[model samples]
Target: MNNLASQEQIIATAILIVIYMAVVLWLVIRGARKTTNIGEYALGTIGFSPVAVGLALAASMTSAATFIINPGFIALYGFSGFLSFGIVMPIAIYFSLIVITKGFRKYGSSVKALTMAQWIGKMFNSQRYAIFFAFLSLLLITFIVLICVGITQVLSNALNADPFWVLLAVVVFVFGYMMFGGANSLVYTNAIQASIMLVVAIVLLSSGLEYFEGGVDGFIAKLASIDPALVKPTNPDSLLFRDYFEIIFCQLVIGVAIVCQPHIMTKSLLLKKDEDVNKYLVVSIIALTFFFLVVFVGLYVRVYFPDLKVGGQVLPMDSLVSAYVVSKFSVYVSLIVIIGLISAGLSTLEGLIQSISSTITADLLDPLLGKELKLDIDSNQILTNKIVIVLLAAISFGLSYQQLVSPNLSVGIFAQNGVYAYFSAAFVPVIFGTFLKKTSLKAVSIASVTAIVVHFSVYYGKFMPYMKEEVNNPAIAATMAILISVVVGGIIHQLEFSKANNKEALNVH
Candidate 1:
């Protein structure tokens, strides 16, 4: 209810934040020296170790959603949210990550593909498809907005400052440095961020050990005392997790396909050699598993505020974790967590800004304006990418400010809508290209189109109205999109195979 941070806490926080920024900026400028071209900027010229890249990968994949927003969901809806967010989703994602990363990196490095749109285009041999996806990648701006709001919430609460000023300062600082550092600085910074996250995750998870005085049984009893639904696998009153279908099936589908996003899948391309893949996957999966399970911290927060009230105001889900951190911890502990929280945000925010800007400059603008503008890929393109980042920062700031002012249920929904759709379209091309041979680009293309259509149609149309309210869940749309893409892509792949077989047989005759 009160501004829990003391004057001393605020001063220490500001000092620590400034020191962190200075370190980051120094590292970034050092990396920027080698980035004479767009290629070097996006892919990084640095010969990074697998462990460093692994930590970076973990940081990129988790984002503010895992550390900040989803925990709020668990705090609100109870065990159903935890079962889905903390348990089932991680299993599905880890399995998918291991299965997909090696093949993707191998092919990506072989072709020297620097971004996801470029990879898809190269794999399908369709420049048009690549350009289309480059434009589609703009949808990731929603995710950037989500991170901006999440970080601002934490910083504003900790500093007891106005959210608007915090939001402005965060955007300028993050996006400004990102334009110079690119991927080279990003991996190093992300590794540091991941290390901090690993520590804070342990602290947050352990903070509630006292509540577990009765052990696992006792913890559940505490939740049950407040609301019996809090202990159940499904919370009927909740919007997202109403049944087995929504909780397990939809979450599993989303987890498996979620990595198809550019910032996530392209992380493996940072590693240099083939032999390092196993080590990278091992470290990343292990670290990310802990990060994912940290959503259970929501349970502790819920127990701390059983009524979910502060000063008689029902806390919004986006701000709940920020509120809880300030109220629960002493100044010293809270300062550490605040830095870690900022890291959680910056790691992914950096990835999004870099990948999206590079995709626009390299994949979209280069193709559209290169010949007409008489531009070269070496120096001119790098300048274009910076310009792109500037535009991206402006757009992100506006959207983020809007969400912070009047959110439609939370910025997470606004993000999931756009982010989910982009990845759903990508799943077919990436999956088929990596594993299956003799795949038809036509088939993959059509399947992608189908996926995007099906996803939006399901969400907007409210296709199935069973045990349900309005179709506000993004996972449901994404799940349906993935299933149909796989099924449709398989059918098309078979058709193309037979057609080729017939043509080859005729040629032999």
Candidate 2:
């Protein structure tokens, strides 16, 4: 499609983007002042108020995946795709509150635990498992960076600007703020950016009403005229139905993985009190629910510009940000689009970088070099973390560029697939095990390994005859993975206990 942004809109958007970035940078730096040590920098020392933690958790997890890709998926699948918000949000909140209640309270305020791997290591008494989890966390972070880069390019297209330069600019700004302050910086900035994005969403949705020339019910009628199924609760005959359900179910299971997600876990850990968890859960669900509604505005674009094409390719289904902004409002909406996406990308990235750096230093490098290198724990840990942060960002930047420029692969799709795979394989075990007293460490091990094996099977076994043409959905795979983890984890734990009881009896005899 031809560029929708007028010069005036482009200019306004550029100014807004600059201002937004400045605000975010300020939040990052200001928060850093309170961060004298690793704990403060990594998890905010005291846990946040429940409201703040809730918003931060909801915002951090709602990346480009939810904003850009989901609406598009909805366009294809209608209500089925949107149902995930309802299913996953409550489950995630419930799981987090239960798992984190004790863990967060027991850990010292100044302990500076940055990653879930550290916490999990303590719980299971297994460094090997922790390292394995640490790597999976790193992989998820990589995909997150890629999504950031991709969204930058999309925002540029919406603004009629050079995609390469825009992506670079966003990367530099995000990296700088994250490097300076870490997770504290990420949360503070996310709160600010999230607020603005909400306002912008309201503006776009309000403006789109003019095009609808109808009230809410009228608009629904119009939408039905285009595709009746667009408003339905299900897609009955779609080949994708089973797959989509799998995605939603798995998403719910893996959503609990947010508890184990290093970046998000640290945010929860940083809060000031256990009471904050409940407040945060409520606030986060409300805010994210509103945000999801705003994104669905894209489906309305289909009603306005049904045949719009960009580069002879029908605007990709994932082009919700562009389609909604371009078709519903004036090009000035690009300002909101860019700011919202940047907000989403940077908040998550800041947390990811902070957590990853701490993991490498505390878990890997420091243990090896601490005594021999004669480095002091506190000062050297900070220095090592900073260095690792820079290196991780540098590597992620390269991978991001490759995905952006790749011939056929879209960064958004690649990330969604990879994240679901990683979460299913790694986190499903930890979250469930936390609540189930019957769950043994060995059972957790079985679940984790099984998930990894199944995940890899879907990817590599694509060439196998039975698997070929199976059209693997990461969501489906993740759901199956978690189920296996839960069932196997429970069974294994029980069997082990049974064996121990038998041994005790035999010894008495």
Candidate 3:
């Protein structure tokens, strides 16, 4: 668990990283040329293959959480973490992704929407609601903070650099490049990142093949040897995996709602044609399944670092995977793995910057201040988008530095709180908008507001049974919000329909 890399290893990794960044910058510059305005930047005008966008979706959806931080959870909690993260969560997410993508994409393409906030506004004929959600897109800054922290951890471990400098460098470089490329550069970079990630995922998943010396039972036995609870489906002493409610139910609800994010849901809109969607989905699902299973590497790392100490320092959960990688692999192999890890963060960071900046420029700032500012939003939107990215980078750097210095448990919790609240509020709108033909703005907006209230209440007020303790789970709060929102939204929609029917009948009579 040594955190320090050798001088040779550091130099080799630094050189390789420079070469990779050069190639990526070239792609960004090329894509930036085609991106003249916000529409083209938001959704690429250049025709891309479904397979590529599909891979990009997989890459963006599976962020640093999947590759780096979440593994730390598994390393600490064992089988229960695996069950929630690897099994139940994936089942719920994949099911939700398959269900929503088709309809969301179909509707999104028809509306010609640029952002998720725009999609919700257009669907319900409510610009005010769009503004609310656009401001809420600020919640995604927490996620940006998560990815920045994660990449900082990986790069810091590889080069034995200070986390502060690494964090600043990461934000400047990723967000700086992202200002120009938007979706066009993002998809190409993501596709390439996804390809490397697929290979890395396979390598990491198979790294512990020798652990399967006997069979499935043998793996369990080894885990049991370390700690009996490590093999259990639910670890009683753990913070998050205490019961079925937390492990299965909470994950199920969050999984269903997780795809409502602008970066993920709008990924399907990148494809120019409908016929390409099936192939896009097919490739993405397969690739993402592979990405999700890579969480198993967490369990492997836990076994690798049984004591969870590096240089006699108790390794923080966020730093465990990076320390393991730096210590486990040789210089050459670790160099490649380091690139894959950085790719994991950059791929998603790029998407979030693109989507959220567009949301700020188009959905929030444009509608609110365009006329007053006398900005020709349609003609010179790209400049506004660049401004948005700069603001995001500054805010993210400040928040991420804070989290890096003092975290609640991990930056993962900080991210989940903000990100979960967002998708929770968004779930009802996206669900009702995509599935129901007859729905009112009043119904959806009320439900959305209710979700926002409930999510915060459950988390901060400690209303849920689980939230009464320290290190409370954000999933519980988000799940409750999504559940309540759906019920409220459905009832309101039905009431609105019934009232309309009565009015029509009375008029006809």
Segments of candidate 1 deviating more than 4 angstroms: 466-471
lDDT of 2 at 327: 43
Residues 302-390 of candidate 1 have per-residue lDDT tens digits of: 99989988887888789888888888999889989998888998999999999999999889988889886455847788778888999
Q: Tell me the lDDT of candidate 2.
A: 0.62
Best by lDDT: 1
Per residue, candidate 3 scores C-alpha lDDT tens digits across 257-291 of 99999999999998888899899989998998999
- TM-score for predicted model 1 compared with the true structure: 0.98
lDDT of each: 0.90, 0.62, 0.90
Q: State candidate 3's TM-score.
A: 0.98
Candidate 2 — worst ten consecutive residues by lDDT sum?
463-472
Lowest-sum lDDT 10-residue window in model 1: 463-472
Taking all chains together, each candidate's TM-score versus the true structure is 0.98, 0.86, 0.98
Give per-residue CA lDDT, model 2, range 383-415, as digits (tens): 767777767767777777666666122455556
